[model samples]
Target: MPPPGGTPDNANYDVLVVGGGPVGLLLAYQLKRFGVSVCVLEQHEKEMQDAYGRAIALFPRTLEQLDQLDLIEPMLQLGFACRTSVTYKDGERVVWTFMENIQDTTYDFVLVLRQMYTEQILREKLDAVGARYYHGMKCVDFTYDENLPRANYPIVSTFVDGGSGEQYQLRSKYLVGADGGHSFVRRHAGISFEGDSSDDQWIRIDGIVETDMPLNRSYGAIESKTHGNVLWAPLDHAATRIGYAYTAEIAAKYPGGVTQEVAKQEAIEAMKPFKVNFKEVHWWTLYNIGQRLANSFSVRDRILLCGDAAHTHSSGAAQGLNTGIHDAVNLGWKLALQIRDATKLEVLKTYDTERMTAVQQLIRYDKDISTLMSHKWPSWYEGDRNADPYHVLGEIFEKTASFNTGLGICYSENFVNQTSALSLRVPPGSRPPDLELSTPGTDQKVRFQHITRNIAKFWVAVFTGNINATRTPLRQLRKAYAGMRALPIDAFVSWITISASTGCSPYEALGMEPFGNTYYDATSCAHERFGFSLERGGIAIIRPDGLLATGGPLDGQFVEEYFSKVMQ
Candidate 1:
């Protein structure tokens, strides 16, 4: 139960992640990558591990984040590209081919893979990082001790072994509640979840089927009078998901409750213009629609909440698991800094501010989409009831295309996002565009995100207008890197110089020993895409999470000021 050794009383850990879901394991993996002592406690036994009927579609931004971890290749191999979406009303096609406009990203299409497979991939990464993952461990309760000496490990958590019923206590510097919607940690911490539940219920089933209707592997939606609306998508393992809403009459038919027989018949009836037969049923679920958010994400700066423990919404937009993954990555680096004593405790507050803002916007979006998909008009609606809902839903889908695609989610200006030094189209709080560049040493081509995989250092990218003028800025950056006290040399910050001139080799000009690797912008694409000037180079401080923290002229004072906000 306790790693085959006797349980130690009051065990020590840098961070205690209270759930073993994707979010919790991700948090643990990131923390351990930076050498932070972290452990995950999950109540589910080893036998029950599989995709729990959660999210399946991964947006472009999520894929980019995974790419930074070097975890995107395997997922791409296992998942199929869902690049098109078609919508119909009463068996007549109304809207066809959505997502054709999102072609600017590396992952321009949604990757359809089951959540269970995603968990398996994350578990492999977690094991590679050597993080401790414990299953069948239940966290019964915990105590927060702010007044205790050496507040580094101020939280005491008591847990019961799910396999042996043995009880023990653990001391950690911080606690994270990545537990799902029914989170025990959130309740124990006295956080209030605020939201409303809708009367709309839906059934989703994954199976191999035979149908006369065209079920293109691409995503599709059908608006029906008897069954409400239906969402169809191709899943892995020769299976596809067919989900439909329960209209008033449909609900009345199953007064005694829905069964496999009833669900199959309802699904068949929902597809009115076609004949359907199910060969095998992989998984099926009945879920109610609801939206909720924790009033506060942190309790006195000691206990933190993330994932479903912090926010909950219906899966109509496929935002539940994607949002949770966002939350995990956003909080991972900030927590690592606090544990390493590299930054002030106040930096942790930004996690709540940034993530809460994103989650609130997500809740509003999910509410609108779920309401329309359920075939229910708003209570204030006075329009004609005969009008097709597909027209209005399609309009909303196009309007929020950026946000729904995950690339449009940006954080508000905070201490981390000090100010913009470069007059670029991309703002301070948004992710920098991925650009291609070649390594000077190996002459190898790579994306800008490839070198940003490490979470321990801030990538100070200094763009030089000319090779002759690069000496001064590179010297200043080297000095700034030397004086950085956040962690240690190169571990806390790293520098890369990009020159616009093709004739000048960075390895030959600037000493390659001081700078890890230099880049050359031969075609000037990086210069044009990043809003950097070919005549006048610019400086951008890329945070550990790849968000542009600050952009400005290459001056030591500006770099010093930015680090001051994070270090002290």
Candidate 2:
């Protein structure tokens, strides 16, 4: 494996990622795992070390997806396990149960880790896989050609080495901009960035702090008449994140503009009635919020975008970083499949369709939360002028609890998430319940996602409701699935037979060899969570990113039909 800041071994790659943040690093890592030649270009000389960056919360679904990458264990070690949320006004508790509504999965609590550590962990994984990301590299400009014979490497990207001030070119089959909001690639490529910017500016400071409020180590908010809705989040390593709207009136107090000292002072004032003292300051920022989405996420499908390059929004709901993670995982597998078989280009198209829909939903939610956090009603508000923004914030907050936590993000029908009877409770396009299962008779517990590792391949979960009742249909499903080798796309799938019956092995328990890998739903919780009958079995097609693609009865032909439509 090349070192973190090492030179690329080759100038040409199957995919060239333009940013080396968490999203780009993870996408590159996943593509490399699938045998795709991938490299990343990062403008920063190195990932952040001492200073923590903007994002701090990783919601439930984000953690679940990270677990699929086998990266969550390290992150959990560095994050604070925050379980509850509290809001206060003048030291009195205010009821807001929106954040407390997160349910299901092992990662029920939000993992509160700084963005710098998140990026570092991703880079470490990328390094272990030998994927090279060049540092101090800036993508200046580039052009593409389809008329020429070198159409396979359609996108030619030009970069300037930040260290040497030398310009160079690298060719790739695809160019992805995981770059930040002011993406050089997006602007240079002439992609339209459409959205509105709020005059509301907010101050967020990360530091070691002491606070008298209970649930200080968890998520907390304060209604400050002067500071608006104050943010009091407990971050990793005994750190507290204090944030408040840097209102125009407060800005007027410092016409020279807010300094780090000013930011620190304001944080203390924001948490009035309850005292807070900063022991150490790690990082802080004061900036205006905006919500922008690219008119298109892909330019001719060769020049694609993800993460902040495709969309930028407020940290109010903390969707900014979580959405980036979603974009990376969603794009990683699709791009890898497309590169492996050019005929499956449609799979790559679904990344844009899927993420754009999710992004639109996020933007609509952010517009309200961001305004509310600043103690202002959104433009759509029709209630009385005397209405409290915090009250309104509470109502809207509860409704979007599932989405804000990322557990309920469901995509529209597409090739990857095809329309079905939607029979299962965890239907196509929705995230599957990460219920616990066990090794066939060992009875050792294992998470459903652990069995479905993130290797840019789909996981076919054969839910055998009960061995005694469904053995015949299970065997028929296995034989029919075995016969699918003629299609070629079947190679991209991994299977696990989960039986509701527990025994020594598949042979001893079900009178059949393990279909692919034998697992026992010892408690029948997995079967129940998946909406599978205790007597009748079925199959679920889990996409590479962990969303259920399509599912139906235990009929191999049904499974084959899905793959045939999604891929050759």
Candidate 3:
């Protein structure tokens, strides 16, 4: 049912996303592509002018998400692709890790771009979809009618337009807060942001620098010691971003309270080992470190929080924008489905469970990275002379960087679950590799890329040499879980039949040979490297984000029973 006074014809919104940052805008774009009506509210009158200088790494998973949205080509054109990163301490080189191992996977390299530029691209996408956004509208309050049944809860929101003193009220069935740290929507919902704020302040600068620094040698550089840490990386054409972090003692000792000049000087000093000299600076800012996580991502019957609104941590991890955008992707499709009246409201609860878990894992990772980067590590002199401290630190650096890039995120215990008795050639929580496949209906060769879209949607991939025997059960399952209950029956499932005689199987495109009785294709190399294990003959349930839900021997009864458990 639509909210009161809503236009009867178009009175109900499938989802209302607050904040117009990259994450919120991308969420709206994805939902709109699925035919969901969405409205976004942004407190700022316009997009940000300056770069945030926060995230420099776009992990393979994030790049895959961008590719799914068809924004990769433009992004790749605008940003620099980083294939390798090196870390140095004092004069000793610690570690260097190349992205080549993961190249055949989802992302070949991390794409570095300014946050402002990223937001601009996402805004253009939203415009293309005809999604609506209200600028200068800051959400001030939210109310939920809990008296209504769980499925029919009415969400009301009040916002004060910065341009106009007049207040406006909007009602929707679902609300998402993608606002950044210090989110008004999160506060209004009375959700606790529990964490500690570091008193240490860090200065960041980005601009066209007159420096005799070599750029083509490595994708990026990081230098750290007991005193502080500094980073220099290429941005756009003829520009670089330099970041320096100072301890409280060093910040206090510096005259004029660690101003941009002081930071610039310190950055120059740190670059002494590289024999680099800077003649000019472009942009700079100083900020304190803080880490926090919302106690809960969802509240009452009306509100949900995502992105920085749900959790925040040190910039060292470079997860700020990536995680938020992912949150938007995870929630957007479900909100759209509920608005379309195709899915029950219970599905909304799963958003909290799924995303909150990911956030918690991130928090832990951030804490670890902070400890490693900060002055907590013992001095090299304190360790055994034979034990090279730099080598030990290098191993830790590689692990921390890997986690920061989001390659470590796993969803083995998501709310959606089903069990199968058939042993899949590939296991659950893994992506199906792309292979040459023949669509059962058309007999045309199709890759996994041809079938699955990156946006959030449930998918059921059935691998069977015997299509005739499986067709009846597959159809019945499709009818039972069609529409929002699963992937829309019309768009979700892809039926393929493969045999050795077929020459190329869908799994082969994914660079894997069918090992078990069943085989399926993967869209990207990331899916196979991280998730798949050779096993054959069975059905695999994949979540909207491409993570495997569960797999087993092909048995309709078992699949239905598992669905029954999770749908409740």
Using Cα atoms with residue i matched to residue i, what is each candidate's TM-score against the true structure?
0.92, 0.95, 0.81
Scored by lDDT, the top model is: 2
- Residue 516 Cα positional deviation in candidate 3, in Å, after optimal superposition: 21
Summing lDDT over every window of 10 consecutive residues in candidate 3, give the lowest-scoring window.
1-10
Best by TM-score: 2
Off by over 4 Å in 3: 1-12, 47-52, 89-92, 103-106, 148-153, 210-217, 275-280, 344-346, 378-393, 400-402, 423-427, 430-450, 454-456, 465-500, 503-536, 556-568
Ranking by TM-score: 2, 1, 3
The reply for model 1, stretches above 4 Å from the true place, is 1-10, 49-51, 90-92, 150-152, 380-385, 441-444, 467-489, 508-515
Q: What are the lDDT scores of the predictions, listed in order?
A: 0.78, 0.84, 0.62
lDDT of 1 at 287: 85
Compared with the true structure, what per-residue lDDT tens digits does model 2 show for residues 1-568?
2345755554778999999888888889988888988989998876444265678999998998888888899999999988889999879998876556777778888999888888888887888888878888888988888775433687788888887887878888888999889898889889999998989999999999887878787698999878988988988888889999999888889988889999999899889888888899989998888899999999888888989999999888888889999999988888888887833678888888889999999998888898988988888889896878888888888888889888899997777787664367776888887777778656788888778765577888888887778878888886887687555766788788888877776777767776678788877888888888878878888888888888788888888787777776
| TM-score, prediction 1 | 0.92
Those runs of model 2 whose alpha carbons end farther than 4 Å from true positions after fitting are 6-10, 47-52, 148-151, 485-487
Question: Which of candidates 2 and 3 is the stronger one according to TM-score?
Answer: 2
Error of 3 at 515 (Å): 20
Clashes of each: 2, 0, 24
